[model samples]
Target: MDSAASEKSIIALDGWLKSPAGIYVREWEQACLDELTANIFGYNAVQVGMPQIDALAANRMPNKWQAATRMSNLDELALAAGNKQIAVALDFAELPFASQSLDLVVMPHVLEFAAEPHQVLREVERVLIPEGQVIICGFNPASLWGVRQGVRRITRSPYLPVAGEFISMPRMKDWLKLLNLGVTRSHFGCYAPPCRSTHWLNRFAFMENAGKRWWPYLGAVYMVHAVKRVKGMTLIGPAWNKKSASASQGVPATNRK
Candidate 1:
């Protein structure tokens, strides 16, 4: 049931992405993802979901792939018809890639709408090699947009997709920590009020500057870059063992006295 609901949610969100509001949201997230993945060094990079925007456009990884549950042709994606990288159909909860093979994975607005967001993340984590990176883009629920969404829900209308369970930044960070993925950096954008009219949106555009200067972290959306860290890697030195033995000898000798 969750999977079916998730699929329906994604289909609805995909339709929403074609709207003016969705375009507004995409502009901010696209620029953020481009910069975050541009200079990142990696061999195998994959972008899961949201083929409308090429998440790895700026990334220079030798091998790149886009995996999604639904069909997305080359015409819709930046991956040209003849390009080596092609979009593949796969479930987010169960990725087809081998374990510890991917160097980088981009999830643009995938988690917020996923029924099994944690399981989706676990699949990404499984494919990423130790120290590998994953870039996540999502709608922030602590901003003006979030407030607006709440108001919409009361009126039986939602500005954003109603099916999505928007995760907060701190909560997202916690989920990553649980999976051994440490958030190295994050960015926020889309400060202007969500409006249908281009004029109204443009008039409030100045809020972008003010919002960044005054409340940078409270943007309408955010992109998080986290790296998988393997702990317990520090090797104990023989000298430390010898020091411990000496310290134990002192305690025994003193006890005898």
Candidate 2:
């Protein structure tokens, strides 16, 4: 991302976090949390970035959930609440956790705000055990939110930074491929139009019933559930690797390294 875009993203994120949009985002994230808890049944489930939801889950389902944050102050609180899985690093793209240590990883709109989304996904892939799952919630770049953002840009509002990139689901799937993860299921929700009371929009049974069935892809937010793939397991990898390596043999070994 460019500097202007990055700045826009930061501004937008800060604003959302402090505005009514935060509540809506939180509701969407909480719904994701429920789905994650139901689908990924295990002794160790890791929720990254969202501490409040983790705390709630810990209280509700003590044995199955743990919360991790980049904030150091939350470490004590997490531990106090029986969550000793706090990560104190400021850069989430490079987490301080060990590889293959977690069964499930929940990313609550963290990718949109991340400086290096690919790196964050890599870190997620690293910490997740084989066959482990990752559930990500993100604002769709092609939905109601995306149109709002476009309007903000046209109007030259200071609400959003130019550096902000609203990622689409297909693009995210491509990123997941780079990390050797495969999407198992995906669902889009929150199609009550982009009003301030977006949180209450999802609560309406009528909207939920119609939006999910008829205009599923037109929602402001979407959720994806993907499973990590075993490395070197692709069908055409050996041939592709040989071709790639041979193509690079022209360069000096040191330079290639």
**Candidate 1 regions with alpha-carbon error over 4 angstroms:** 70-84, 87-90, 234-257
Tell how far residue 192 is off in model 1, in angstroms.
1.0
CA lDDT of every candidate: 0.84, 0.66
lDDT of 1 at 180: 96
TM-scores for every candidate against the unseen true structure: 0.85, 0.72
> Cα lDDT for residue 234, model 1?
64
lDDT of 2 by residue, 1-257 (tens): 64344434655564565555566556666766675556455556666554545523622323344443333346455654454345555566666667987777777666876677888898999988888888887778777667877788577653323455668999999999888899998878766555555455445537756877888888778888899999665554434677778888879878866
How many angstroms is residue 31 displaced in model 2 relative to the true structure, after the best TM-score fit? 2.4
User: Which of the numbered candidates is closest to the native, going by highest TM-score?
Assistant: 1
In candidate 1 the C-alpha lDDT for residue 131 amounts to 89
Residues 92-164 of candidate 1 have per-residue lDDT tens digits of: 8888899999999999889988878999999999999988999999889999889889888477778888888
In model 1, how large is the Cα lDDT of residue 225? 93
